[model samples]
Target chain A: MENTITSIFDMNIKPEYLFIHLDAVDNMDAIKQMAVNLAKQGVVKNSFIPAVLERERIFSTGLQFDETGIAIPHTDTQHINSSAISIAILKKPVTFQAMGMPDSKVNVEIIFMLAIKTAHGHIKFLQTLMNQLQNKVILHNLINSTSKKLLINNFKSLFNKEN
Target chain B: MKKILVACGAGVCTSTAVLNKLKSILDDRGFKGKYELSQCKVAEVPAKSSGYDLCIATTTVSEVKCPFIMGIPFLTGRGLDDVIKKILKELEK
Candidate 1:
């Protein structure tokens, strides 16, 4: 289990992958900008933008936390070249359809755009992420952290703690 | 063993997370040997849900044959006790 977690939690989140206070008026715009940034970083294919958008339209990754609203937008492995997670802190919260309840809306401030290369390969990492999000203090720190370096360090520490 | 189906959007990411959490919960409740778990995508639920005793999914689905439980609480840590109670009750029946 430890080995599996060590391998699965190998997130390629760098300082460059972290965006702070991005100016996106809507959910699509937020995903597009993040996907484009990930593509430029050579983490995902160029087709990732559209595919992520379509998946968001259908599945709707919007999650409502007790303290704030966050979204985890991801698509199939076909649209990705590698596995990477990009973090974007929007300047203004954008409206997103809540997960499991499409009729409900969540105004999201932070977006975790996941670019995965395969299905069923990163279970440990994904579980750790979900468990981490449940902590209000961690989410609060993530959203309030202003420095990109600090954010990267904070995320790395969180992932590291799981393994 | 009782078969339980768990599903999410891509059938890979969120569903697996739910699966692990459910496994531990069931194990803690002394249900480790009594239950079996399966994971799939939401699109496959309508087709595959018939074989399972219960379907626990993170995403909303159309019509499923068996009793369905929402698995979001497993992730968000909100109302998780109630969700687990529902699962246990369904398994008991």
Candidate 2:
């Protein structure tokens, strides 16, 4: 049981999943670009694209922090093969409907596309990510990271601190 | 004990994040062990919300039997204090 719990918390962000300064015209474009990469890597099923797009339309994941705005776009577990997070730092900000507020819009700069395999499996990781998001320094580091290695290192450091 | 229901699009990502933040806030505010939290998809809110003292969702939900709170601030880190105040007010009642 201890091993199971440890392995669950061992979720890693793959180096290949990190895209620096990704170019996209809109929110859907941004999501599609990242979703396609995950699909190519066999991280998620082909159905993930449509499922995530449809889900975003109804329940947006766009979050606007004080200085930076980010979005966590994800779909159901059925669309995932393995649990992974795809990070895309867009070349320019794209407009996304704010979560729980369809009338409001957020200009998102970073996108964290989550491909989760279970409902409650990554609670700790998600919590840690939320805490990191609240940190202006970390969010600044993430947004200004120009290299994939730097971004992945910054991300890995979060989990490292947790364990 | 106060019963809290938290829902997102798929009961996975955002809800889990919000639930974690809510737990820590409530725990700090002297609510530890005094409440229970359950996660579900937003579609289930109408049916599951009746039994909960508060329904917090990352998206808009309709026809919730309990008082509803928009949990986006927990994610964005904006207006979170106000949301926490609202939650404490609801749960304290």
Give the chain B TM-score achieved by candidate 1.
0.97
**Candidate 1 chain A least-lDDT 10 residues:** A1-10
Fraction of native contacts under 8 Å reproduced by each candidate:
0.73, 0.84
In model 2, the Cα lDDT at residue B93 comes to 98
Measured against the native two-chain assembly using Cα atoms, what DockQ does each of the candidate structures obtain, in the order listed?
0.75, 0.80
Number of the top lDDT candidate: 2
Shift of residue A112 alpha carbon in model 2, Å = 0.4
lDDT per residue (tens digit) for residues B1-93 in model 2:
999999988998888888888998999989999999999999999999999999999999998999999998888778988999899999889
Model 2: DockQ against the native? 0.80
Candidate 1: residue A3 Cα off by (Å): 26
In model 1, where do residues sit more than 4 Å from their true spots?
A1-8
Tell how far residue B63 is off in model 1, in angstroms.
Answer: 2.3
Tens digits of per-residue lDDT for model 1, A1-163: 0112112365567767778998997999999999889989898888888888999999998888897899999998898887888899888899999889878898898999888787877778888888888898988888887878766766766677766
